[model samples]
Target: MFQKILCIILFCTSFTYAQEHLIVIGGGKRPADALNKLIELSGKEQGEILIIPWASGEQEVGFESIKKDISALSPIKVVSAPFAPLTAESKIVLLNQLKTAKGVFFTGGDQVRIMKVLEDETIFKAMHERYHHNVVFSGTSAGTAIMSEKMITGNGKLDVIDGTQVETKKGLGLLPNVIVDQHFIKRQRENRLMGLILQYPTLLGIGIDENTAVYVQNNKSAEVLGESQVLIFDAEQSKEAMKLYFLKKGDKFDLVKKKKIKI
Candidate 1:
């Protein structure tokens, strides 16, 4: 009996170490087909998946449906981040869940709220460790914005950006040297994103439209997936001036590419 128990413990430990996956879903409407494709790409069955809906006011609506949709492929364990009445114990629970999860996903909501809750050394360290271990970290919509070093914050309205109005803020710093903006074409956010890029020419501007995603790997090379195109703004090789007032909608900026994409 003692020998059997010891063997069982070892088996569980090895099993836990074998599962490593991450998926980032940008907010907007996630197509059922796209969700399944991501699950398939992760190379893990849905049964091993773990969803972290931290950005949704800590609400469960956005994640619940995703859980249901993905479950068709396999069963997924959905975990909600603590909100409103955050306690030490609740925080620990979230950390512990992440530590053992095969995959971690961020749901869309308010980016500021998500950062306010997770901007700590301990949580940051855990995320770093998990990413280093090859855990898949992904988010949608507001969740996607927080993955960058700088993120746009405020309402998706044109008048929201005139006369001393600033909508960008420091983000989670997960994706170093980049700034992310979401709901691009659907909300006509290109002008605002361009303004941000001009303000910080050193950073790369990545605008993900609705139903689209920029899947970034550990090496920093990313691919755009979904129904929309990802606009990449690189000021490294541009000689044109990026004046805030002179910017126009749908203006194209040239990027210095190491390799041209064939598609």
Candidate 2:
């Protein structure tokens, strides 16, 4: 019995280590510190990083800006992968670019645009495989919203938090058990997030403020970083009303435990 228990423990430990790491940023001006942390996780001094500009209408502008920002941090090579419509040949070519990549970064724009380009493509499959193998995946704004299986379309208004006004679609499904909203505080989007959580109480809600971000590991915890705060709404912990908690820089949250952990 002791030997069997030991084997189970070993398997759990290995599984945790194999899980992907994600850096999700809120919209606005990109925080320098958060970008630096992302680069550090992308193997720093070595390995190449791929930037996907599918979310933006201005692909070249998005590519150059992101490339410049990432290049400013380290000497690592950052290549842009722009998909020209949907084609089998293009999918194979895009997957080939990721063969030697250590990380994948998604720039902000329209989350639906990203889904239209990447969904059911070979490139998406390759990215999912790399994520489990220690490749760092980072996204900002619409990029952050696309990290979850349930993505917010920004179709709702702040006048009220109702299900009828809001809309959600399938995302990348990298982060589980939560719905993420970007530019939370700046945009006064608390109601929208609260509405989603109330409608789907089983899932957690994360409202990330501008100029801030969260470094999420596996499905366990997220460490807050940058100049602002990240609001967490826990439906399971609420009593009669909503349960809300705010986390700032240097703060860490227990995603699965639904509590704050001091770092």
Candidate 3:
């Protein structure tokens, strides 16, 4: 009997824990296929997905818009986290929802605004902890920006490729070792991302174009999905010179290995 209990304990302890998966869209209209994919990964009718719209000026409007889009995709139970400037009482309720959420989405607006409420230590810790334990996180625009640990504020130098000219802040840290940019090709916002990559050579820079998304299911199976292209600034691979990679739909990259998968 003791041997049986010990074997069970060993099996449970040795089981591998899952890592967070990300599906971040650059600022623009999201494709239905992408929404469909999110629904599939989020466990559809089996589990709940939480959406946080603190980034938008009108949180309710933003929340409803995404909830509607997602609901149109499937019968997934979609819940909204209370908008930013959360009170202690409301935060508690939000936290409970977050805990049970199989997936989470952040609506587009100002990345700074989203970070303001998320910066609360307790709230931040809860999110960080859940992400590590495997949650599918999806977002658009500014929501995409908040996925990294060091986030670009989109407020700094626009004309030049100078590291010092860019303004940035600590982000939600869901996707570490990478700085994410939204609305890349459409906005022609390459200078800022290149500059940041030069400044933080150790970090990888991913510029996701409008309507496009880069989904990372662990670091090994990162792939681009949607209509546009995603630019990759891989300074981590070669510190001496930065190489720019333009990826379209169906392209895959190993984020940890910093290599492109030919598929």
Candidate 4:
């Protein structure tokens, strides 16, 4: 019953933000189709791309990699600005740049670093607005983990499924009700995701394997991409009712209904 109401709420939110979309990569090599989809949904010709590389140690290289990759596919304008030493003038410039951006990409490094850089309420609100109205947000690895409201900090005891063994922090909050984990299969992250979902039953835990992605459209439905799998953990009713779902490349999932869809 509670899960059903959450679904209805999700529908209403998506209806309001009709153009929202997400391309969450699970680290490793990104498939060509995913990159192309990002370019396509971002308005192939007229859209602007913004890359956030603060999470990366070498921000410039990280920024350039995204710019080059997307630019190679399409001649879209790509730009980025550092959040460090946020000057009033620079902040204004960055905010303005965001205003014209149709796609925003985050590089992988430390999810905590990215979240700390985005601590300003104004910046968060701005991103929240653009993301809902007309933006395609994407990321990989640590970038992938930060998509949810509560992010797994890659800490705590790993051998057990205890609630105390997991540590999480505030993330981008783009998918507040869901917990995202990247490089799932490659790193064998079943324990963390399973532990978290079992601990927090109201939220869903999505573990995306390397070379794979879960493309979410209109804030509701998620479709698998690349030649890997996605694991979903849902425990809405209780820990005893917790269910695990496996999805592959071509599978579609209804975020609201919490089930795999044929169409």
lDDT of 3 by residue, 153-231 (tens): 9898799988789999999978889999999999989999988898899888999999899988764567888999999
Mark the 10 consecutive residues where model 1 has the least summed lDDT.
243-252
| lDDT digits (tens) for residues 47-86 of candidate 2 | 7888888889898898899889888888888888855474
Q: lDDT of all the models against the reference?
A: 0.62, 0.86, 0.88, 0.86
Q: Taking the tens digit of each residue's C-alpha lDDT, what string does model 1 give over 222-263?
A: 655666656666554452554221112222222224222443
Positional deviation of residue 149's Cα in model 2 after best superposition, in angstroms: 0.7
lDDT for position 18 in model 2 = 85
Backbone clash pairs for candidate 3 read none
Residue pairs in steric clash, candidate 2? Answer: none
TM-score for all models, in order of appearance = 0.75, 0.91, 0.93, 0.90
lDDT of 4 by residue, 148-205 (tens): 9999989987788765688999998898689999999999988888888888988889
TM-score sort, best first: 3, 2, 4, 1
Kindly give the stretch of ten consecutive residues in candidate 2 with the minimal lDDT sum: 234-243
Error of 3 at 233 (Å): 0.6
lDDT of 3 at 212: 91
Winning model by lDDT: 3
